[model samples]
Target: MSIAESVVRTIEDKGAGAFVESYDPAEENMVINLGPVHPSTHGVLRLVLELSGETVLDCRPVIGYLHTGIEKECEDQTWRGAVTAVTRMDYLAPFHNEQAFSLAVEKLLDLEVPPRGKYIRTLMSELGRLSSHLVWFGTSGLDMGAMSAMFYGFRERELFLDFYEMVTGLRMNHGYNIPGGVWQDLPEGWEEVCANIVSIMPGRIDDYESLLTENPIWLERTKGVGIMSIEDAVRFGATGPIGRAAGLDWDLRRDMPYEAYGELSFEVPVASEGDVYARYQVRMAEMRESIKLVGQVMEKMPEGDYKNMDPKIMPPPRSELNRSMEAVIHHFKLVTQGYTVPAGDAYAAVESPRGELGAYVVSDGGTAPYRCHVRDPSFINLQSLASMAKGGLVADLIAVIASVDPVMGGVDR
Candidate 1:
């Protein structure tokens, strides 16, 4: 059964009253509000935990602190301009959001990106994956009281962000990936720069493993804590490292290839233990896999037109715009009015560092989309919290929340 169906079943089997009961015979259960502001909850999420002392009997996640009506806003912007809004939905893995939105637009336009564009996209996406995992590692460690690990992880992540800014002008919210292809080709000396960074990252990852993987305190804090069975993880709609750690090998990049992912080879890491340590191990392995994919994309880099030649779909080259009046006009029209799409619906998904990041887009044969909805993995993954947190110590609650790594931007968006 699908994840949604599984959640419904679990809810049905374990009735609401079983998890929570009245605090007083004459009153309903005491609802403990755990933050639209608490540090442990992460990013402005309020959890209504029905608690009997320190033990959580039941929990309901209250979102919307970061909600920006981004999906509704997408319906008003031009197709090319919408990337900026969507990228902010999952701030850590912006490229996946861009890729999903762009792919859906490409499906509407029926345009194919050139070989060079595809390889660049693969490189960027991998970098994004690595950066996101780094944040997860760092913050999860900090949340569990591993202060040094947090600093170390962010240190490496800064380097990755530098590479991102070099290629895409902006460190985040890069409207680089357009409908037909990427915004521009890689800058000069970019390959050597990227290669140098790639060579150094594995050693850094090794450093992280040395610090935490076998450390007695780290192990105690994480291993076997907040255990969720494989069945429960799938039932809760967990994805990315959270689900994969529980032995759910559901990576959209591998299972449903898009862009140049099919041409590249990488392993999807899975661990049977669905606990904090297992999630950490899965993300660590995934970082290595992302590095491998980036290396392959660099080696197999191709030469061709970056964007599609179709004038209606893509804007004219800058050189052409400067020299030709017609080219200038075309560029203006493409930017202001946007390219029209056929009246139909398309769903495009990518294996984001978080999970199956998907976009469901509908067009009414107009310049703007009729409807756009995102199937955010973080939003779905957060659903499992009550299941994992129950029957565990209050201290383990922090680890459980960190393990899932639900960025409220994605959840609330």
Candidate 2:
């Protein structure tokens, strides 16, 4: 269909909520900016809103406010070192970012990560998902005027951050997932700590649901508001919670297994409402699944090397360097010059909390990548904002933005 036909159809279909409403030409449509600074925009996102009274007529997302050119910077660093930059793209789900870049590089080298390493990656990735979703749950509640949900969400999220610090030594943007595997093995007594975390999550999720799921105010604000049809969601490239909420039953983890996902079992949470409430339901269900996956990883955790032992890609162990002069030289060269990848390009994607996070790497048989690009779900999911917000109340727009959950770091990267 033509652009005009689509716009008219959208208007006609929307009925009382139509975006293109007939208004007096003499009374000019009000133009307003929602934010590059507003809290609900979810970090440096500006929505140029054309409004008639309090209803949104047109919404245009103005991004690049937080752009740091990280993709270009990745090209300047060694392929192994690029994870540092990639992890910072989606600050909320940093491990997924790291995993995507690492997987792409591993594909280029035809390297297989050890079973233990894959399990560790899977464990960390799921923990990261929990962390990301917790923040979303809290912030979404805060947006709807339920202040306590914000505090509760952050409180639960801190536990996972502690777990991250215990394992990776950093809470956010930890470059733990390297090309061949993880940076190091789990710390002593990690299994006990992980078990405790998963065990308590079901009750905590119950707490979250009790607070907002059936609350009359939340239901009034969210149900039937900011609805997106499955077609519009796909056209807008919305994925993750948003896509699943719209009845798009596509998940990269289940459909395209990576790491230890193929060996693990978990259900993908899906909903058909495609509203703010449906988005909430999808994410909440996902957190429960993440907890289940974490428990499975602990039970099925394998025993083996945590990293690839290849001399070409990995630096010699510290024990080896003490006995052999060649090990010393190899370690020095690997640290300073990095390993060379065969001339080729590869793309690897992982299911992130927000959506599909992918990395594309090109090599010229050199240490550094010739080109590096990330397909961030936040960037693509942000496109659905206009469709969701169009014809909705200005207040409802805040809820819609919160539901979409576009992190500017990823969107502008």
What residue pairs are clashing in model 2? none
lDDT of 1 by residue, 130-243 (tens): 998888888888888889988998999888888888988888888778888898889898988889878989999999999999999889988888888889887888888889
TM-score of each: 0.92, 0.94
TM-score of 2: 0.94
Q: After superposition, how far is residue 67 of candidate 1 from its true place, in Å?
A: 0.8
Write one digit per residue (lDDT tens) for candidate 2, span 1-413.
42333434444476324334444466666656566787788889977677778988888776788999998999899978888988999999999999999999999999999999999999999999998999988888898899999999999889999989999999899999999999888999998889889888999999989998999999999999999999998899888999999999999999999999999899998999999999989998999999999999999999999999888788988899999998998899999999999999899999999999999999999999899999999999988888999999999999998898888899999
Q: C-alpha displacement of 6 in model 2, angstroms?
A: 20
Residue 203 lDDT (model 1): 96
Number of colliding residue pairs in each model: 1, 0
